[model samples]
Structures are given as structure tokens and as C-alpha cells.
Target: MWRRRTLPAVVALLGVSGLGLITVGVTADPARPPRPPVDAPTRTHPAPDLAPLPRAAPVRVQIPAIGVRAEVVPVGADAAGVLEVPPLDRPTLAGWYRHGVSPGETGNAVVVGHVDSPAGPAVFFDLGRLRAGQEIQITRADARVTTFTVDGVRSYPKEHFPTTLVYGPSDIAGLRLITCGGRFDAGTGNYVDNIVVFATRTA
Candidate 1:
């Protein structure tokens, strides 16, 4: 039977299989505080009056500020009920939670990628560098390009990861880009924080 575990625990479990390379330490710091949260603003510009897509899956995601352009793959929960991430081997790929709303739909669409891999920096390596007003573009299977403007970027301790806020329902189309960031815990082999970019659809 599947068991419920904190996101960090699940990440640690996955780390055992090398996926933790996303948060593994490149440099060590033992003086890091036990609870650290990086919170970004939640302000957004007015959205354009564009018609929403009719349930088509996203094909690609592009973030110009960070130079990330990659194919999007659908992912679901694993046998243990933990959310599955993209394979470590294909570090350039991004995964969209299959159970969530599609990018152009009227809800929160989540896309997650690794900040780095064992080989080096990955697709979302610079995700935390994104600033408010940055653009995030997603191409749908129907050939429509949906654009989202960054509202803010925040990093929260994994233990206090705001699952509901990140995955919550939205009246308008929204997008969330997630990756590991903040201080790396060499002892645990995982990042102490999760960097989240909140954006709202503009076109």
C-alpha cells in the first residue's frame, strides 16, 4: 500500500537513486539554519484577453531569461504515491504533472525540472534567477503558444513546502515552475529549499 510521506522525505528516497543530484551539494556549508524560507512577491500584471485552450497537453516550455527550452513530458505518482519527476538521465527535459490542468487551461499547471544533474547544470539550473515580469512560454499540442509572466519567485524549506498554495485552484490560468535551491545539505544529500516561480497567463 502507498504511504504518505513529506515531499522532502520522498525526495530523499529518490535521491538514493541519484535524482537528488538536483539538490546535491557542489559546495558544503554546515552553519545553515534549520528553517529558512525564501519568499517572493505575488504580484502580477494584467492579463491579455485571450481565449483559453481547450484541454490540449503542453509540448514544450521555454523560459527566455534563463535560456531554458525543453520538451515537456507528462508524469504521475509512483507506486509509493510520491510525485514522479523526470528521469535524471534526460536532464534537459521538464515534467508536467498529468493530474493538473494543462498550461493554457484555467487553473494552476505545474512544471518541474532539475536545477542540475550529476553531469552539470540542467534545464532549470537558473530558474531561481527569474524575476518578476519575466516571460515563460509554453507551446501546446494544438500549436498555440501560451505566454505567462512571472509574478514572483520564492524558496521555501522543503519540510514546509506549500503544497496547497502551489497546487491550489485558480480562477485564471496560472503556471508554476519548481526546482531545488537555497543551501545544500551535504549530510542529507538534498536541497534544503524548493524554488518556486509563480506566473500568470498573459496570452
Candidate 2:
């Protein structure tokens, strides 16, 4: 398991791993310049915030900006309170933090995925490429689709991940998408940082 982000530390969202799976050679592009540290407010509203939708588990997620369309599976924290990632072998699936509010609801809903696997780039490999004004669509079990407008994308060193800001309570419907990034550590078989995308329900 990766460094534990216990329930207490992150409040309701539980754990998140900067290292999703052990990769063979895929890593962050060393040539790409690093992004400035993220200091944005906890919630961002590009358009008027949409009212909270009824409780409905997300079934699918589509990020057209990065061409990511994947099945969404509910995953809870393990006994050690570490947030669980999708099985390494199933790299195309994204794991939703089932314990938190569902997408389009009134609080933060989180989804996590691997940037890569032993085979190659995974579902969220291009997550870091997303930018503000882009949109993320989540299809729920109730057949309702909630669209969110990207507020920002930030890469944080694992050690400095803002637990409350990323996973904390929100006044309006919010969404968080997470994956690993930064330099790859050959010794640890993980990345040195995490990429987080923040958005608010726009429709």
C-alpha cells in the first residue's frame, strides 16, 4: 500500500495514493515544466452552481479533453484506512470514493485512477493535461448526467497534499479527480507527486 491518508486526516473521503500501481517505465515527462503550486479556494464556480442532485452512484465518467471514458466503480477504504485504487490489472476502471457524497450531490465526490500500469498509460494518464474551462461528465445510475466545469488542475507533492482542501466539505456540489504524476521514483516504484482536478457542478 502507499502512504495512508487515514479517514481522520482527510475527513470523509479517506485515503488517496500518489502511487496507484507499480509501473515499468512510464513516468512524467521530464521535459515538461512544473506547474506553480495550487493555492486556489476550496470551491470554484465557473458558472452558476447547479443544485445538488439526488443520491445516485456514478456509473461512468467522460473527460473529452483527455479522451477518457471509463466505467466507475465504488471503492471504500481498506482496514488500514488507505483509499483503494482499482486493481492494477484493470487499468481502465476508475474508483469512486463510495463513502463520500455521490457526483452532483452537495459535497465533494472523489474519483481516482491510475496514470499508468505495467503495460502502459492507463485511464487517467492524460489527466494532468486537462485545463480550466474544460468539462467533465459523470453519468449516474439514475440515468442523470451531471456536467462539471473544470476550475483548475494542480500537481502537489505527496507530502504536501492538502487533505482538507481536496477532500473537505463543500457548500455546493463539487468533484475531485485524482491520479499520480511528477517524477517517477525507480526505487519506490511510485511517483513523487499527485495531480488533482477540481470542478463544480455546472449542469
Find the candidate with the highest lDDT and give its number: 2
Clashing pairs in 1: none
Q: Candidate 1: lDDT over CA atoms?
A: 0.73
- Model 2's alpha-carbon lDDT is 0.75
The backbone clash count of each candidate, in order, is: 0, 0
RMSD of each: 5.3, 4.5
The candidate that wins on TM-score is 2
Model 1 clashes, total count: 0
- TM-scores, all candidates, are 0.82, 0.84
Q: Write the per-residue lDDT of candidate 1 for residues 48-117, one digit (tens) a residue.
A: 7767678988889998887888999997666554567788788899988777789989888888887766
